[model samples]
Target: MQAILQSSDTELDIVRALRENCERPFEDAHAMPPAVYTSEAFLALERRDVFRTEWLCVGRASALANCGDYLSAQIDDQPVFVLRDASGALRAFSNVCLHRMSVLLEGRGNVRRIVCPYHAWNYTLDGSLAAAPLMDRQPGFCKEQYKLPAVRCETWQGWIYVTLNEHAPAVESHLSELSKLIEPYGMGDYVETFHEEHVWDTNWKILAENFMESYHLPMLHRATVGPHSRLEEMECPPGSPAFNYHWITKEASLPIGNAHPTNTRLEGHWRRTTALLAIYPTHLVTLTPGYFWYLILQPQGVGRVHIRFGGGLAPEFVDDPQAAGYMATLKTLLDEVNAEDRRGVEAVFRGVHAPLAKPGHLSPLERPNYDFARYLAGRLGAT
Candidate 1:
């Protein structure tokens, strides 16, 4: 472990800064240093120590409802894809072609076969090499011998997670406590009505930390959701090993932001409460009574992040006569919120590059950010 994390001096400096942050008391803890986000060496360390070893969420399983629908993604440089097979079971595998190493798929869509563009070689929905054109003419080139490598794909409460580490703990087992706490929201049943992919100019950790804290909601989002976010109404308890969370009661601009009238699981003020969850490295979910939305982050080097953004109505709101209206309102609000966040996170990325840039002290509202910093440090720290 030390050899992996301590491979380079620059990375060692960044990890030391992170450990220093973790060593402080709650009131005294500061933000992690800028190098954690800007250092290529440190990003390389995370590529090995964090992304390769964690259960990274791709998107919601609801987005891949039909057979052959697949989501393509990467961990470090290893390209992978996850799809719902013809048998209706979800599976993931290397996206690279076995013939000439072309990526079998690009982006998400329904397909009859995973065809390589470089060559005509194709694969079944289950990742079996279905056809390798003209390969039969070659000696001893069995199609079975060229099947795409399998990867571990797991569904945790409707979210699709894939990991390169076969020895990693089960997704369900890792988030069991979080499941119990968020059970009343019926998160697994919310069908995703919208899914999108975008690349943003910001460090992935900066974006992850942005989603982890609501301290800036009243100011950064003042033109949008800021007015509804009252700091006093928020709750940030100590985070657990696998994740961190915070909650706030919202006076919604969209009715769907609150619990639907048909919702019975939530009573009183619980209907207007929203739970913000940071599941380990990169899965951030805003689970509300009437709807839910999430961001699955993937780092593109040290300065850019590839984001899978999506959301949908809760089970109660999905069946309402006004479901279309709710979906429209939710999408509009999300677009606005994302625009605001994009501006904010991108600015922070620029600021981090300044010569005097350094992490500052944290507020109580930034507890989740503190926890997230520690999570990053813990992952890249030496044994």
Candidate 2:
């Protein structure tokens, strides 16, 4: 095993400086200290205070619609798997086996029982110990006491969320107000059509901050989204406890297949707008008239993040005869935008690590960046 990184007073000083900067007014606020981005010590602090304790969005619950469907992932280094049990309920369990601590599952699959590759000890879909061959001779062994451990799991608006914190609030209670803001989009009725995972070579915060604001659209995405975006038309409301959203309104330039059959209830601006929101800690999403896309971020270390990227169209679009053909165009567009973002943010990561790097003033357009910084500061101070 690799040796654990230890924090020194110098690192704590960096954390203190970042907290101070986060408390500054938006006009006076600067970015977080460079150390906060490049230091493993600081990442450790965030893992303990933020990632481990906060409710994290994993994926859409609809993805695991069948009884035996399951998705496996690492939540802050804790091997975990979420499955739909025989009763058709979503469940999450430590992917680690009880016998010799072997990981019980990998990626996504449909399994009747989870069997450990190292030892044949198996667990049922509901996380109960099912079988342990050749263990009858053990003096005090008891299968009942060896069932796989469960972690807290919840679903809200068809999205799956899991938290390692035992005392965390219910996902719905935290997101109820945000639901009101998104109800107009009929987000719940949208079916996921594309899902992919990629590991980015940049700090998680860099990408998180990048996705939360559109200030870069005019420059970073010049070849694609730039021409369509007008920074002056953006409306970033004040940050709230659950999430922060900003609107970007622009008329459709080119029709891919069909106009998004948006709800008539949505008015003028809503008809041509996209709301980009960051649900604090990690879940970042964008809701548009015809479709939605989301990014579920998992920090692998100070320099890497595992991203769960997914997008889907409204029920109307899904029912369209050309749905498949339209989705092909949509996926291509998303991939191009993602590539543009990847290049931009990775460049920022390199700059952040330079010896002369320092926090710079933030633009008003980067309100989400400010909100994200405050959220990180709050997490650092909690507990």
Candidate 3:
């Protein structure tokens, strides 16, 4: 790992503390030590054991419906791009050009080929080297052998996931139970309507922990979702090896849409409930009756995270004549809710840096939070 991302003595001590806490029972477990949020060495370890090895969700396949659509991102700080090839297959490759190591693309766009601006080297949509100016003059240089290295890519329920680890389990296998739990939501058919990326001034885990539980809703989101939150009705079941989930039931509301018309198949409290899930490392999603939204997190450092925020309406709402207008209203509402979360979580990040910062007791409502700590500990090889 680079020195910029390495850990310090204080950080190593925090990792030791986390290992001790992981040995305790869930009921006796406290929150993760504050240094875990601000330690560069700890972040380096997480990048190796968690982000680089897990099936990190990049975006939805629907975002690249047409051939040649591509999106670029830094997976564990490694430049990579996912694109649809001419044959309609989704593929991922190192965004680095094989020749000079310059990034081949930026952001998302429709492209027939990836051209490196640094040296004019180009690659096909499938990452095979297409053209290398004057390379024919270089003796014994083989164009075929210079193709960009492939990254492991998979899709589950319309979402695209990529893992840098060749040995990682398939995305579907990892989310098998989660798939059945959310089968009624028809997420495979959900159409993404909006996406926005933001760089937040907070540790990735801090933001993810906040996302997994609604305990802070009544306080942090007091002006937005706080009013409608049914904290007492929240239920967080134990997590499986691949994921953890919690449920909260509440009456339906508008602008965000209510019980999806085609979703009448769900029964009783399920009709009024939402499932919030954290898929291991960093894919966070909320499955509801009418719509679904997710946060795909990428840790930039100990104190910063990159987030891809997106969501979509159910089939019924997507078919509605006023779909666009309704979506606009919902986007505004969700943006406000996200802004509220950012402000609150950023403050927590600042607090985590204090010398006296210590792990506090968790509440029953923080069951998912407790589960998260265990997952992290296990990934970090904590006994």
Candidate 4:
């Protein structure tokens, strides 16, 4: 682990600035300008300055557990292919074929060679161009020069992340504080159970802000999550590093009494707690007692976003029928909650475009939201 920088006076100054301005109380519910969520210029700036520069989670390491396994994905519209080489080490490369810019792979599968259907070009799992149908007759064609371009890839806590910018600092550097915050959860020991993906009509920020606070539980998710969880039990403590926020929410125990609503359980089999971690610009991880769920938000456009939910269980619980069943139940509950939020977020998205719409202030409970907005503003060069 790299040492936390404490020697440079400048480092302390940066920390001080964050401690001060970043936590300032949000004044009005309208402090965030509506333009930030609906403007094309702002979205373009984020695509370049935020999405392209950060280490974004691409998939779970377990996705490529076997030597020949591979998965093709897009991060912020940039094509990428991840594979486990013959040596068993994982690598990521731009999926675009060098010869004619064709995508090398379309979906997930195991393959000995990535053969481009467009031109019969083939490359090994390690990204070396092994064969080109007519390269021998083509002038200026060199095997060494046709290898797929590589991207910066790293694995931490059993998750794989890739960065588009070659010059960006190591992933660990950017995730330093976040790593420490999540280390206690034993995330590396978790094995995936199921994966879910969906597209939302609202801006990604709206979804993020919704997760940062539980104040809406009493209203939005009363049947799904509200009765089980309490606002007082969801604590968002201070001292988050720049670009991230951390919180702990006591899991709602099954409700009791005939007075409790129908269709909602009054008693669950076990009590669970959730440690929530939000990494700015688009990653959300919920560390539960039995499993963890990670949400990766991909911005498709100013008003569209793709959310991928990956759920995992501890290695010991992977084969436990009860644990696996519970995880499935949890996934269903989360899906219901997300569905409710989607409706409201979409409404907000449309309302924000109205002529009467304006920036909103932050609630004391929403300090994290304010912190995130500040971080976004800084990264978008709006600060």
Predictions in order: lDDT? 0.88, 0.83, 0.85, 0.72
Best by TM-score: 1
For candidate 2, the TM-score is: 0.94
Better of 2 and 4 by lDDT: 2
Per-candidate alpha-carbon RMSD to the true structure: 2.4, 2.6, 2.5, 8.7
Model 3: per-residue Cα lDDT over 1-383, one tens digit each: 55433445555677789888877878888888887898777887787778778888999888999999999987887899999999999999999999878988998899998999899999998788999999999998899987888999999999999988888778898899999998877788878888889999999999999998889999999998888887788888888878889987777666344566556656777777788989878889988777889999988778889999999887778887876887788788889999999999999999999999888788888888888887887777432
Candidate 2: pairs in clash = none
Worst 10 residues of 1 by lDDT: 1-10
Who wins the lDDT comparison?
1
lDDT of 1 by residue, 199-286 (tens): 9999999999999998989889999888877889999998988899998886677788898887888888788889999998899999
Q: Which of the two candidates, 3 or 4, achieves a greater TM-score against the reference?
A: 3
TM-scores for every candidate against the unseen true structure: 0.96, 0.94, 0.94, 0.84
What lDDT does candidate 4 reach at residue 306? 86
lDDT of 2 by residue, 1-383 (tens): 13332355655777789888988888898877888889887888889898889898888887898988999887788999999999889999999988889998987778888999998998888888888998888979888887778899998878888999989889899898888887777677778887899999999999998998888999999998898788899988778766788987777543422236545646666777777889988898887777778998999888898999998877777777876786788788889999999999899899998999888899898877887777787777477
The global Cα lDDT (0 to 1) of model 1 is 0.88
Clash pairs for candidate 3: 6-41, 7-41
Candidate 4: tens digits of C-alpha lDDT, residues 1-383: 23333333433343344344545555543345666677666676678778888788877888788987987777677899899999999999999988888888976789888999899899998888999997889788888887788988998778888888778677777777777766655677677777768899999888887777666777888877677655666666663544555444453442211111221211242224466677776777776555677888888898988888788776646665466566667777878988898997898899889999755455556766777767775665422
